[model samples]
Target: MNFLTKSYLAYSHGEKTVSPWVILKPLGWLGSVIVGTRRAFYDHGVYASEEPPLPVISVGNLTTGGTNKTPFVEFIAEQLSRWGLKPGIVSRGYGGTTSEPVVVLNGRGDRSVVGDEPLLLSSRLTDVPVAVSSDRMADVAALLDHDVDIAVADDAFQHRRMVRDVDIVLVDATCPFGNGTSLPNGILRELPGSLSRAHAVVISKSDQTSPEALRRLKERISHWVPQERIFYSRLADPLWERWDGERFVPVGKNMTAFSLTVFSAIGNPHSFRNTVLKSGAAILHEFEFKDHHHYDANDLQKIEDAARKSGGKAICCTEKDIFNLPRGYVPRVPLYVPRISALVEEPGRFWNVVVQALRPQIVVASNGYGEDAIGARLARKAAQRFPQAEVCAFPLVGSGIPYKKIGVRILPPLSKSPTGGIIKYHLRDLYQEIKAGLFRQISRQLSAWNQLRSSCRTVLCVGDAYLLCHTLWGQGKKALMVATAKTKFISGHWKLESFLYRKGCRKVWTRDEETAVELRQNGVAAVFEGNPIMDLSCD
Candidate 1:
């Protein structure tokens, strides 16, 4: 371990007292305050969180390092797929070199490009699509092309910008909470109280700790979350396979004479060692590297030298380490990779919670007062049509008063523009709105829609072409447009607007029959829905 990790572990475990305790304790307190305050922003609505259109399952941990997130994510994806749901995985690509979102199709992307965890997931779950990007919203948007019905986000506990339907947090059984302190002084990324945000808490590596200790940990965790939501899991099913210049093939334990030199670049190298030992193989020598370490020619050479000197018939490492190895560098010694899977207790109940979160959603969006009126009716119509699905509203112009009046839930509110979304009539107000951060509002609105609009079962856009543009920004599938702002008796829609309607919308509902007929002549799929906006005044 490095000096920082070593010191952190020592302090957290209460193993040693350091001279810098005076300095470290205060800093840890400060960190806790900052993290808590930031969370409060999201909790109290000071910051806006975007709700995903599709059901999103987030696997994250409160601790700084691995709590076996990748294995659990794999388990979730496999389960979702078995249940007939087209699931996709997204990661922040922590330790990757790429900036743009890279889709891992058929497990083809390089580990160096997409990061080790995502590449490993893609390789194992070949049928499941994986996307890696710093902006996870971009990753979700990219997955839409694959027709994914749901998404599983890896290591996204604190990524509250995009709200998850199901939040599954993993806690290490051996070190559930570090020394009861925050980071820099301990291992906790946040306070134990954050467990309240988690829909389910998983005690990972449950086999690593004694039953008595595990029970006590559960009691402490229950203070923050419900006891029924807590689940136990362990990494099980250890197998050894050898690389044959193409892929790993199952190898017998006797193939290496039961002696191996094990090396790994993972968060918990000791866990890997324990797994190897469980296979009844004696470890002759061991090489350990930092988590996600990139191995070069020199590193490989040293590992090979150690294997030969120890007289070990084979060199072994975890499956994740294979990706970090130098490309096409064949080792002189026989190389083996250990594959392990997570075994969760009461899997049926755990999966039931996940399945429940996969419920579909409908989003009603509008930009103006009259548009909001139409959107309110659409929201009611959607709620009546799909009673089992969630119905919500996204107001692009102001606080969704119309939706609020109708008792429909509204997304995070944005600041209203100076002209109240009527910039065309009062062009001078556009400059004033720009000064009031109109561009920023538009960007935020688009980002809000990108995930929620993209994953929603249906999108109802009520407004002019400008609102339609925002509606379609994140929606991969076509949307239903209720054009309330324009009419044929006045000035009709422009050619560009008609083209957008024909190409982007599945069907456009006009305020009057004349406008619908005019749009039909131009090959647009238009319908006269009888002015819902006029009915608003009658009510």
Candidate 2:
């Protein structure tokens, strides 16, 4: 282990010295705060998320790698394909120096150009399209171009920019949350509470840890995720493939005849070595490299020399390491690659939940930009609170740009006037709407709502009494209203508006408590849950 790795492992094991503690702890806290704030910005719709038309299932971990995300991604893609759905894989080409997206299916995947993980995915998943890019949105678009039914994103739990239909978070069974601190001091990318954003949590490599430790880990995870949403997984079904001078072919697991020299550049090298030993092969020499380390000529020379010295028949490595090997350099000894498949407990139940999330819908109804923001925020809450629901937006006024910004689906285009529906301040604005064919737009929107209302279980109206009246009229059901236009601090709701609130809406959330109190006095179910408009500023 290097100095950095030693220090990291020390911190992960709860060993802290005064000097490093002072420096790294504060940095970790700052990182946690930055991530937390950024997550809040995305959650409140201050930051826009790109939503692709096809369903996306993201496999990610809260920590910095070592949670078997890649294998689990492979598992998901294969499962999706088995179910007759065309699945594509998207990854951040971390090791390679690629400036743009390289689609493996397009034959643009050079190992040094697109990185090892993407190449490994491309080679392993025969027909699956693998797109690598630093920009995940670009990768999703690439997958869309390929006419893929679903996109399986690798290492994207913290990537709030792209909205995911299903978010699967992986936790390492041995060291799950990594001492409970953020990077530099520990391995956590975000706080453990962030697991609440995940639709499901998979405790990976479950067989590697003690049963008691696994139980404790699951108990701790249960604080954020429900017990039913938590699943256990282990690396199983190993296959050994030996290079026959040109390509690797599957050789049965009876490797006891040959003494092997093993080397790997992966998240968990110890696990790989354990797997090698379990194959009944004798390991004469061992080498370990940092995760995603690119092998150069010197690294290859050292490994070959060590194999020669140890009198090993073959030099063994993991499947991922094969892509990172120096190009055009062939090893004199036979190169053996061991591939492992992830086996999840109760996989049927897990996939059932993932498929079910694609069903239910939540419609956010709004009339203005401010109302759109409020509705978008509410949509985000509904998404997080109820991961199964597909949250979307229906703007009564101008095109729902704010909803689109936050990755909320805009039901249908609505006509816009020069005044943007602010007719109360000027009659000239109403004339602009009339000229813009507001009546025709209203008729189309009502027809669209009638078509959509039956599919949606919940509708959130985020405007004035006019919007509430329209939403209730269209849906033929009481909607949860966020009364953004009228407040007691400015001008309280009129008696007619109060009557509409009482009769039409299920609940009204006001901008201020005084407005809610006044509306409550008039027999309206009004609530003051702080001002959502104040969340408009990302700062």
Candidate 3:
């Protein structure tokens, strides 16, 4: 079962359940194993490929959902069609029963076979084609056989085997990277660094993001990919498109202050909520589902009931969710679908770069991997330079476990001062003892630091020191707590210093210029190297 389903079930039972760590521990290990095996298989040429007839444009993201990929794909397909080129869309047909290539919209055949989005396109245009297949490569090949000029892969970022002419990565303006970790550990599909391979970075949901936040995000992305083309786009919500059985009817008016029964099966329901609110619609009720959730008859009944009880004027949903709903569901109520479009502030410069990459002169090769994982990629580079050295990984232990077990439980001192001492004095004494105890515990774990110091030339840390310390202990490294003033410290000052001392790390790196000055004033010899964390690129 998925994380939400398991969590909900546990809560419903009212039983003491395992923590997130307990659950993710096995999953994390499994993910690591899968990644490793996949890499090995690729290296051994287990899954080789053949080239397709035309250029393929993949619209995808590292995270599961929230990126406005569907609308962006539509935009690209429309642009291609306008240029007198036939573009065929190939999707994984997520949540659909069909596994084989199904021509949703042939541009020449009956439109009923096509889904809502495809049908919507078919009704509006007569030159574009849309199809779905679980095997994306096969679908693209089939489209090429039909004499299509170009093929667009919808949400195929993780499918690395199908070589593409251009890769467009979309980042949601909010929560771009979830806790900055892979699935089971966090929300990311691949490591954040994998974005470096993207040809262009499109910031979606820009309307909800502040100018300052957008600037900071850009600055962060600039560190890893200096030459990447970044573009800003927002979802236009004031424009409405309602499906009238066979075609979408555009309603030109600001839908502000209208009562809506908002329901969606998209990854980020909160994003939909904010979008509707921006359009001046009051959300009377919100029905959220798992990503790409296929709505059944019972689900429709629930929505109908909620809409009636709330006295909503209409039932609103995302374009994706509309395809999954029953054919006659919307006719029963005042259902109005909000059509989403990626409004690019600058299109000329963005398309120029995309066209440059699409030029026939640029030869592309399949890497046989979707995108390299950060740890694995780093290990490979490190191995290349030091052929004989062993590569070790120090990953942060999943936070889910600790958070669930502790449940806000603070660590306590092992002993108390004698009864004769003043209460304040006793408290101070207890604090010092506890600090010492923490140091001692850390020191014992790192006793083999000397061995690692002699054998290994360099120690690679997966992330920050708190999690790094555990990995260091696993690899027998003399981990010096690289304390920064910016690091969130929960305990008292004395405790923090003591903990650092026990970890065998006295060298600290300050993130900001002011932090270095503050640390020096406080008698800390912190070097202002700037924040390493900010250097991360989301592509």
Error of 3 at 493 (Å): 70
**What lDDT tens digits, residue by residue, belong to model 2 across residues 313-425?**
78999988887776666778889987888999998999887777556578888888777777777888788898867888898888777777778778885666567778887
Winning model by TM-score:
1
Least accurate stretch of 10 residues (summed lDDT) in model 2?
Answer: 42-51
- Which residue pairs in model 3 clash with each other? 21-400, 21-401, 257-280, 480-505, 481-505
Can you give the lDDT of residue 418 in candidate 1?
A: 71
- For model 2, the local distance difference test gives 0.80
TM-score ranking, high to low = 1, 2, 3
Clashing pairs in 2: none
Model 3: which ten-residue window has the lowest total lDDT? 362-371
Give the distance in Å from residue 413's predicted Cα in candidate 2 to where it truly belongs.
Answer: 28
For model 3, the superposed segments whose C-alpha errors exceed 4 Å read 1-22, 36-46, 106-126, 243-247, 362-539
Of the two candidates 1 and 3, the one with more favorable TM-score, higher being better, is 1
Q: TM-score of model 2 relative to the true fold?
A: 0.70
